[model samples]
Target: MMNDKSLDIETAEGNAQPPHLNFESSFPSENTQVQTNTSEQRSAYQWYVVIICMVAYILSFVDRQILSLMIEPIKQDLMLSDTQFSLLQGLAFSLFYAFMGVPIAALADKKSRIKIISAGIAFWSLATAACGLSKNFIQMFLARLGVGAGEAALSPAFYSIVADLFPKDKLGRALGVYAIGAFIGSGLAFLIGGYVIGLLKDVNFVVLPVIGEIKTWQLTFMIVGLPGVLLALLMILTVREPERKGLKVGEDGQIVKASFKNSVAFIKTHKKTFFCHFIGFSFYTMMLYSLLGWAPAFYMRNHGLDASQTGYILGIIILVANTAGALFCGWLIDFFSKRGYSDAAIRTGMIGCAALIIPSVLFTQVENMQLSFALIFVAMFFSTFPIPASAAATQMLTPNQLRAQVSAKFLLTSNLIALGIGTTAVALITDKYFENTVMVGNSISIVNAIAGVLGVFLLYKGCQYYRDSMKTENLSKS
Candidate 1:
């Protein structure tokens, strides 16, 4: 049943080798290339790489989402409308985060992923600090764009690198831990930003020699942004790029690189899996950012809570529930696989999607603050439960050279739709459709209910395709 072109190769040490990066030219001799392919020869530093990559991911979200907590200050400072602020939060950042990902991901497929990651970490971290320096709309928008572009470099490379470092059986869990970074960074953005702003609320703005006066929110951005720069140095000095694995090598032993046309062509051969996967998650993301971007304001408006109180409650729920969901289900994917469920990740994702619907819809419709928070908390956990499994499944389906590019495609579609449309949909329903700000809760309910159902349908349809891909993979290995 195996595709003849997809069989495993033998290593110089006489052991079966998994598909790996074509580094034939770099090796200079066939014997050297074969020797490095052995599982026993893998670098001992792999787990450290995963930990640090997760840190970078955490920092990316912190830099990106910090604006969520600082919305009121940004509005007051710029004398801006809600539309203008939303532009900064959604469109401005997402444009770069989406388009810039492809080229960077292509580079990761060919060059030093470690170097790419370090440079990205430094770029985004510095860009986040620069956000504090901007005095006006155009300047701040550019800064946010820079943050997006820099973050675009991280996940594709990290996903590709992580897959090679972790064996297939363990990849779901490793990626699960990596996926926690997004939620962690998101939660911490609110926690750290709220705490910092609260601490500085009574203090007068400080005037610096060149930068002039800085507000409390501005200072918060600068302080949180600097630590990631230090972390970038650790990545460069400590992490070694693992030997690439699970790729198709050519007859001459040359690792063929993916071109845009070819990659699309290859993806089409498995269009059902990719399309269902992309569209499903995109809708899932629509529901997610709808709550995330608007929920704090919703609480403050309806429940008589202040910014600090809203941040504390939402932050704790996001961190604990998302972390638990990602870790537990990620491990569960591997566990199911070992128990003869070849499509375990897809099954887990389907379950998460189904579970997410009711809680996601009800959380917004409820009037009681306690009930609202509890519903949303359960929704957040289930919403995130699918990410690690989806990520690992994507890697399992793609070849080594194409992994980053495909992963980039994954991020681009999900974020562009999520950040671009998800937030806007809720706003449109409230501002345009109902013509009443008080109906924000109803708007959230309508949008999430539709999107959550669609997400469940697509993920369910994609399950068999994921299983088919796994069978193809197993056949290739045999």
Candidate 2:
């Protein structure tokens, strides 16, 4: 006879065996085991979800940027000052979009991200259409506010979704692909706006009791706004909710709730990465947003080009340069990561890009129109190349759990300071020096060049923090 403990162990091991594997069945089916493993992998549809999220992001950007191309026509019709126009493009829009993003992103962390995104698209699309109906500065300002409110839900929620869908190693490429939406949507806005305004230059619609005559600019807003409504419907009807990774299951099998305080705590613990990304992106946005918001008007006034011509030329440049920059940065970051030089890659790329920006901007102020445009294209290409690296750096520094909130925090700082203040600063400078467009342009260039230099310092600091964090993480794992 066997001892009690040995017999008990044998009995427990025997009980652990499945009935099919027991004497009741001589052999178990290999097909059944393979089917279970396949189901596990099928549980998460990562790439499909990334594609859908990217589509929603594209619509968000198109709605925001359509106004950039239409600014000239809108300014002419409304008789608006540069200061007022800047308000519409920057502060009026970015104020709500920046502040509202935090809470909405927090909600995305807790609720269904797909639902938040769908609702946001619908709200903003309707608001864009409402912009067409505005009779005065106040009405247009309010419409822009609505647009901002809707857009606030997009980036953070999308970032959260992307983080969940892709592994750490693949995230740079994933974000690069997603960022293409920004370039494509912005390019399409200018392309479509130019064509529509060109086609409808003489066409006027006299309809409705309250709204008598509608111009092409007004019609442009209405037409562009409608498509997002359909996109919103697609988002709501088709997209399945993804599971929130790293959540704990309780005794009753429900996901244990994560607190906002806990989220803040996580960020506080990683403050170095948080601040570095915030400043680097903030500086980058200051330059990009100001340029995007003002470039059309700048070209129209200084280059003596019609809105349609200016739109086409600038649109083509931005489309090509931005797309290439984003994709290249993504590739470089991923390439360097495999060699254990992720931080070094980001630091070198951003610093090099930032250093070139000063000269690039000065060159854009050159007297020759063709030369200026050519130089601006080069400046834009280099300026935007580091964007993907900055994005990846932000994602790498934060814990996976707080990625969305951290992104929101980064945007809040970047947008409020860069997008909000940068555009306004350029507009104010232009207005003060309105008598001398050349001087005005030079002033704007100087401000941007200084901001670019600051960005290099911030990026370098971020790289150091990233390396230190990686070391700490490695020791923890060991």
Candidate 3:
């Protein structure tokens, strides 16, 4: 491996040749020891890239998740069942979002990531706004599917972009900061959604000049979705695509395409590690999506807090607590990884499972409302803790050629199961078994416990495989 002090110097100097420069002179590098210049990778333009990507990530979550806060309004508006609403929130979105990731990621692996991201941002933003125009459940469902398809193009590109932009030493922190979009966007979705709801609550209807005749929830979707269009334009204009380092590059300064077979072969070579880690993350995602998707409903049903009130409290907790936890976990992983404890990332994943299991399961059962809020806040923090470390670990394991596709496969499988299951399992319990909306709290507890147990088991089993994978990379880089 590159000496710690030398890499640190390289990082601080930020004056090395771009890694692609080396790859351009060579082809099919077997060693994958990319000597990226810290100067180029850590430049002002580089940081600009991460910051804008973070903003775009934040907006994506806002557009996608605003529906969670508007669940009741949408339910009443469309005259739907909890199961049907859950379909809109869960399976309908996940099916397209998860499945579409593979092809889009394959595209990202060969094409310009910025084009995919910018165009996707514009597409999803418009799709999110289209939800505002839906007068029926089918129309809303189809619009959400469009939103999912657009979002499918992002994360593969996002992770791949960040991996190329930052070196190994700084990747954890950078990705963690980027991952904050997940929590922060969700928080802002609630915050902005709530604030919008409050504004329109007293008024019967809102009428804009060009787009006349909209309701409260519809107005909220338009408010949250439209800004992203402008953000997408800014992204394409400003965010330069990072050169694909440690791989073959074309004359256009892009990575030469790797076949889908090559990506699958890579995964096949490390089946145990990839499978266990992917499963662990999927289980973790299950617990997370449930809390974010249904917690507002829980607050409304059990604690007598309305949408605005639930949004304010939960939004504060998610924005503050989850952000702190993600950054701290990122720092911890980087610190330990630098010290040669290469198992740091997955080990952190284990710790996150422990932290979330009890708190998340107990939060809904707590008798006191204040204590319940505190517990849920704690739960949210730990739920976010695994993301950065786990993602950094995965990125570290692969070369640029395989990174985006591997990430897409992980996203595809994980979201299909977790998003499909996590977001809907609670509602299934409430709608089918309990037959009461107030029973959503019980559903949350049950689902969290199950997924937590699964996460702990899978992550534990993967520890040795993770260590072995790290050692493999060390040898190659060295």
Candidate 4:
């Protein structure tokens, strides 16, 4: 392994190279060390950081997803329409979550990612607890915004950290492990949230110390949200930031400090690639969020199940199907990468999207519960492909300084479309077009069909664009 002095010299030597120099010739020794380290495999501490990051991600999703299972009770208590509830689920959270990521990720690029992530985990956990204290639509909306803002700090920073920790060969699996946290957390939210709802089913309200009387759903938020604070502390104490790799250099032989503007300029240099990646993955996530945010309600209303029952079933499906899919997709990306596919990430995404279309649209259209669930399992399995794919695509091509900012940009586009538009699009169609509440399944099917088709087409194009972008980075074999 390269020591700190050798690493500094490596960066300095690269900076000493001329502008427009061939990338492969600019850092021969660094490239050799990279190849050597790939064979050395990752250390125990590297895996430890990945595991801790995964835990944080798990908590983040649990807090975010628990609200889906509580739709009926929350709507009843707050006197909200489907549109209003959709705003809480989609617009209110996503608006801040998406936009805030850019600025927070800029900080992550320059600052200590571990600290940034720790602060974010602590803040979001508290915000999630605050969701329990919400008395009305506006209050819940505000609390959800806080949750979004806090969570905006996590992924961009985590992606940057993980990329620095692992080589390209092992990056997909590490990120895949982290991505599975989304499913694990969502699963727990549903499974445990269901069990809690069942326990609190007979009781309408709970009396807490000083807080007095509150709905059981409110208590559920508090239950799942608070443990994250401790996790944040654990991270702060244990995980040290890894050395930044693949940094860009200025003509003056100094490391280039990244800003949002620099990040955007870099994207413009590979405009077609990012356009396909950002927009394509946005459509994919549109299908994903629509399903995740509404599937519980689909089971409840369309399939004649209650909240607890819907939670239990969907939770199990999400846990089993989505988690496995994330892991398998990560390995699949590595599988393709090992075979010299420069567009492995996007290629994997296209495969998953193609397989996802029928299952996503048909799952809700089916009348039989077993058939619907089986289809849902398949849809969910493919839905997760973007998790590792998106991360790997961004990290693989971006400079270390700009990785977080670029990731934040992708998050902005993705969440805006997926959460803000996707979730609300379903509600709008159901309320205005269908003119019925119980026809949510139809709305789900329509959105998934449209989004899935667009997602596949764009990703298919993305494979070529991604390959071209890799060539631009001088990382492609072709």
Candidate 5:
């Protein structure tokens, strides 16, 4: 039998009325406080779990980002417009990815997170391979949707697991290490995608056993996607679920699993902080996804570079610049935390938002290609700080039972506004306002400037709200 404490609160009004929580006096739990010991050093096993999780993250991004590098060919093969291609890259994946995260994360909060993550890796990997089988726009869109739905299961659970594994002092660095997978995967997607495109640019088609002939791009998807299945199996077999920490307990000494509604209630209590966090990060990511989605097209159209060359260059930049940035940002958050800054994560995010703007906009506006690349390198470096910072911010503030759900809420808002709207916005501007494919560079600059400015202003305000919210909660970190 499972622990009774994990049961949802049983009240006359059901979940609509959350169990009484008095943060002003103490944490919401009836008796027990959070169980994690901040002084304990993380073990070797914990590091292993983090490494496996990072590998899974790497594969997820590879599947998601590879499509960006194949835009021209996919459009040519499927007779798609720029807007239609953007839908496949942005909306089709993000719509389901964002919407599905809540229910999956709810399960993460209550069930075995290890199993959830493994299953997700398997599902998305297969979904990615399925994208290779698509022969039409509708088919591709559906495939992308499947990929999104499957990937929706990852980050929230990973964040929850990592939060349980490490102390608050070390949480940012651990998560920052995990965040490296995103850029690594993105880099690999471009590098491998570019290499494959170059290798097979001459080969028209190849015959499969039962499936008949397939395009080179189709083969590439299958190659990248199928390996994740084995990785999923490895995760299921090797990784053990970490103990849930900082959970609420009732008067009878049973842990209380916060209902979805309870999670919402907690969020409502700290609405200002969440509002700034969700919107600010969403806009920051809007700039990021826009650049990632369209940069290949920009280089190909404006700079007279082919797919392979652009991919190689961009891949190197992401691997070096973005990876370093993520690690530094993680360390930076931990540094701020150690120095008695309650708003460390938000403060770090504000710095990145402010620093990245000039370079982000100027990179595209510049004439010299090498100078443009240098600016891109600087922008890319600052762009990564928010990834770890945002996760650290949420994990530090929320109680254990509600961590995954709250993180999911942030993902839903961030992905929708960033990936869905932000990416599509660029395509719309290029297709309608500019009415010229070569003007995509301008579209990137405009979107970057608008999003960057908003991110800085909101995060600036968020620091104050975060500090206010911290005062109310009895966080372990404090």
Candidate 6:
């Protein structure tokens, strides 16, 4: 339940004059009376918002993952090495994506979130299509950088919208639903990309006079990129911006704006939750980046499957396990919070997941292909199960006004540390152990396991912070 004082402040928007900047509120107060329908009506609208955001998110992942499917074809055509491929996959995309998220998030906070999201969809979609036109490694790398830049705007805006649409109690479920887009988009990219590329193999199309005939992979990119344009149009037409919360003038007559300095101050004041979330997100990205970026290649080389077959099998695992894990984590977090164990849910989930990952990684190194596939599915399930908890914890720690910026900051920190470092680290390790494929596989398992353990410890600390915060709030009320 919302605090009575908070609700009063929310309702008194027109009655109370805006507070001045000199006000000493530790957190920004809810000032805007967002035009919302009744609870039942708003509940229905929230679902609609979630659906649209999910589609946008789906498109984002589809654009991001398509490159991995084309890595082999691109490498063969461009005459590139694994190291070069790794740069295209990780560093090139992550560096710009990480840096761009902040400014994009700031824009989302200040502008219409729907517009930012729609523009991002179109931008990344075009960038993906551009990938098919690249003549060399450098061109492909630059195209990927564009794709990353576009994607950097998505999650922060989407998260802020979700927070606005749903109440605190229901936010976990909403966010979990949003997270499913990651799985669905990634799974579909592999499944559809493989089939599309297979059909287009050795085919020629006269799409452009200057470019003349285009091959299968190029056509695949163009086909995939075109759909996002339509999705972007839908977002612009359908989604409405919610009223900004926590931007109200308090009794002191000051209007609150969430600035970068304010965001940093909030984190500094909540250091434990801040650092724990950062570390947890880093480890999460390490596993996800390594898996998504390289799993298809792993299947092609180790399991002796063609791209299409590998994509289908992996898609099945992702569709099933990732969806289930996301839903399960949301349900568990809410349930545990009701039972007075808010942070325990996340801590327990991560620790158990870490334990499961060790064996899953070991099994992935097994020579038997069937056993390896089964283990990979198990690994993916456990690996993603804590995502809801981690996301929820981040949202819970920050005030409403700074939600987008904080979420973007979280992504920025995590991406730099995890996606940037994790994928590059795995590639370097694989290259170093190239003389022994067994050692390469083993090294990935070891690095991921160690990271998972560290994540567990961080989550425990997050739990402590959460508990202390709750106690402090309770005391203040008393």
**Which is the leading candidate under TM-score?**
4
Model 6 scores a C-alpha lDDT of 0.75
Residue-by-residue lDDT tens digits, candidate 4, 216-256 = 99999999999999999999999888899999886699977
Residue 300 lDDT (model 2): 75
How well is each residue in 315-375 modelled by candidate 5, as lDDT tens digits? Answer: 9999999999999999999999998888999999999889989998998888899998999
- The true-versus-predicted C-alpha distance at residue 371 of model 3, in Å, is 0.3
Instruction: Give the TM-score (vs. native) of candidate 5.
Output: 0.90
Q: What is the lDDT of residue 114 in candidate 3?
A: 96
The best candidate by lDDT is 4
Candidate 4 residue 115 Cα shift, in angstroms, is: 0.2
Q: Give me the runs in candidate 5 sitting further than 4 Å from their true place.
A: 1-42, 249-255, 476-478
TM-scores of the candidates in the order shown: 0.87, 0.85, 0.88, 0.91, 0.90, 0.86
Residue 316 in candidate 1, Cα distance off native in Å = 1.3
- Whole-model alpha-carbon lDDT for candidate 1: 0.81
Stronger candidate by lDDT (2 vs 4):
4
Candidates' C-alpha lDDT: 0.81, 0.73, 0.85, 0.93, 0.91, 0.75
Residue-wise C-alpha lDDT for candidate 6, range 204-228, written one tens digit per residue: 5436677766667777787788799
Worst 10 residues of 2 by lDDT: 469-478
Q: Which stretches of candidate 2 lie over 4 Å from their true place?
A: 1-45, 204-211, 246-257, 342-352, 385-387, 433-440, 473-478
Best to worst by lDDT, what's the order? 4, 5, 3, 1, 6, 2
Stronger candidate by TM-score (3 vs 5): 5
How would you order the candidates by TM-score, starting with the best? 4, 5, 3, 1, 6, 2
Across residues 272-339, which tens digit of lDDT does each residue of candidate 2 receive?
Answer: 86677677768866777766777777777777878788778878887897777667666766776765
lDDT of 1 by residue, 1-478 (tens): 6454443322333544433546565546877667767534454467678888988989988898888777777889977655677778888788899889999998998899999989988998998999998889998899999999999999999989988887777888888889899899889988887788777778758777888898877877788888988998998998887788888565589866666665676578788888988888788777878777877767766788777777788889989988887888788888876677766777777788788889988987877878988999998888786568768778877888899998888888988888877777777777778887667778888988898888889988998887776666552221
Give the residue spans of candidate 3 off by over 4 A.
1-41, 209-211, 248-257, 473-478
